[model samples]
Target chain A: MESPVDIQDLEIRLLLETMLHRYGYDFRNYTHASLKRRLLQCLAVCNITHISEAIPKIIHDRAFLDQLIYAMSVTVTECFRDPPFYRLLRERVIPLLATYPFINIWHAGCATGEEVYSMAILLQEEGLYNRVRIFATDINGKSLHQAKEGIYTIQNMEEYAQNYQESGGKASLPNYYHSKYDLARMHSSLKENIIFAAHNLATDNVFSETHLVMCRNVLIYFDQTLKNRALRLFDESLVHGGFLCLGTKESLSFSEISDRFTPVSQDLRIFQKKRGIR
Target chain B: MKSPHQRRAIVIGCSAGGLQALRTLLPELPPTYPLPILVVQHIPANSTGLHTTLLNHFCQLPILEANDKDPIRPGWVHFAPAGYHLLVEPNETIALSIDPKVNHSRPSIDLLFESAADVYQKGLIGVLLTGASQDGAQGLLKILHRGGITLVQDPKTAEAPLMPRFAIAIGAATKTLSLKEIGHTLKQLGADTRE
Candidate 1:
């Protein structure tokens, strides 16, 4: 008899294979250990007894699969998260972008649009919002829909306010949103230039000519191969001298494409795409 | 009961007073310790890696903030980074998760313990230490069910005993020892394994 661990490995492989063959979504490249946890979490949430049982439900039921997809995808995000990174962006990155007549930014794997709105707020304050367009994308359509809505719980505002102040915001964070009852809705002004779309980083084509790509907390979930693939896409997508910001926990030091970008703020994990010297 | 020499890995979980306890406990595991140690200590999502830095200062063994695809090796300690769940793969490599938090913590004790249990099975030794919440209870139970050795910090010695108390209530711990005793136990285990 196979050990429980081996059995789980088999089940997860089958589930990923089924997902790829049946739905055209390839999660096979995702880090295995995390994927197993997610599959098990999905199994528990769907009230399925086991992975083998969940696979058929996922294959046959579109609605259930959507729920499963949302659960599996990394969608947790907050406004001005890691305030220092935003501060670095405001201090160094934004000034360079201000020189451009038109700015194009991509917030890859933008979960629920917090970072999207946060970026808009920064550009607006910098007097550059009118000249910028942002493409905020995630693999999960449900998250895209939520990002488009721009609504979050009111309780999160206090934390966001603190983060905003720490990120060097000159105005109160409340100035960017309207709150009623238990929910806070971002002002429509912030949403004007943002195009929310469902784009899978794993399978999508390069988003060309982007000046900056902020994919914080997303790459840490991928295996080295998938991370390299994504980094290559970023390298291809970025304009020369463009910026890339990653989560504090992530690093380019181990990546095959590390040479394509040089450290702008090594501590903050911000990098500038090397201009022809690379 | 199996000798400490039989264990393949050591997994530990704590939350509320984890940092201080780690400072006291980590230094006790000699540089020549033979088993890999994986730790899950709850911290804010925006943690600045200070915990690992502080722990590294006191530890003789190399201490690292766990990152994706990192290999798990003996005589080194790995702490789960903030805002991510850390897991041990069957191949003895590290895996990090941005999956939703468990027990209100991203580097959840349960996820770490459970995954380590799956990977190491009976070869694992799990320790539940001081914590305000009961995050490690179910994971310790899973480790126990897998025939792994389970140790909980003696509630009397724990700064916040709810976590170990719960593990004890669930009949998860094979032995309950004070912080000093736990360190001594681990040191003896390390020496035994080397022999």
Candidate 2:
């Protein structure tokens, strides 16, 4: 007999296969270690004892599958996450983006919409907001709906304020939002130019040609093959001299597409597409 | 008990006041130490990677901050970078994640320990050191349940005792040793494996 862990992993593989065949949500290509942990976590939350037990429910019940997919997707995010990267953008990158006649910016895997809105706030301060149209996309429809509303807890303001100031905001953070009871609602001006939609990086092709793409902290969960596929998608869409931003923990050094982009800020995980390359 | 020759990797976890202990422990292992070491040390999300640089500056082994899909190799040490959960794959590679933090820490000790346990099973050795939180306890217990050796810093010797105390409370530790003794034990294992 196989050990329990071996059986569990095998069951996880079967579950992933069922999800893909039944729903077309391809988790089969995700990094194994995290995929396993997430499935186990979802299993516990669903009150199921074993991973295989959920496979049948997931196949027969649409609501159950959606709930499982929501849990399985990694969506950890914060407003103005990684203040220094924002500082680098607000100080340096956005200015170059300002030079463009009209820019298209894509925030891929923009869970809950915090960082995408943060970008709009900075652009408004820079007087670059009106010229730029931002497309914030994610794989989860539930997260997309929340992102569209542009509302977050008032309790987050203190941390958001600190991060905004450190991201080098000259105006007070309150200038960007209105508080009602317990919610912080972003000003309508920031929302007007942003179009929130559902886009799957794994299966979907490029949405449009873009000036900049910010997919921070999303690609680290993917295996190398999946990451390369997404990078290739970005490569096809990014205009020459456009930019790509990633989290500090990620790098292009080992990627197949690294040759086409040079480091704008290696420390900040920003890369500028080579003017000579496509 | 499995001999030193049978173990494939070593995992160490710690939090508050762990730097002092790591400084003492990691620096003493000889350059020829034969097993890969994976470490999860709690740090702020916005850390500048200075500590990893400082530790690599003096340690006999080549110490580097882990990157995504990095191969796990012997005689080198990989520390989980700030703001990512480091995991070991059955393919003998390291994977990083920004998954929700466990125990309020991004590079959570429990995630590292549990993931490593899944990959290495009875071939793994997990160590818990000084920490203020109860993060590593469950992971240590997991390693124990997988038939791997669970070594923890004796709470009496730990700078902040809650972490190891929790592990011992759960009956997780196979042995609890002082920092010096743990260091010596690892070095002895390395020597025995080399021969």
Using all chains and alpha carbons, the TM-scores for the candidates as numbered come to 0.94, 0.97
User: Which docking class does model 1 fall in?
Assistant: medium
Error of 2 at B167 (Å): 0.7
Error of 2 at A209 (Å): 0.5
Write model 2 residue lDDT over A21-49, tens digit each, in one string. 99899987888888888888888987999
Error of 2 at A189 (Å): 1.0
Give candidate 1's TM-score.
Answer: 0.94
Instruction: State the lDDT at B132 in candidate 2.
Output: 96
Candidate 1 interface RMSD value: 1.9
Instruction: Return model 2's CA RMSD, one decimal.
Output: 1.5
> Candidate 1, residues A30-123: lDDT per residue as tens digits?
7666777777877887678778888888789989878878878856788998899999999999999898899989899998889899999999
Alpha-carbon deviation at A154 in model 1, angstroms = 1.7
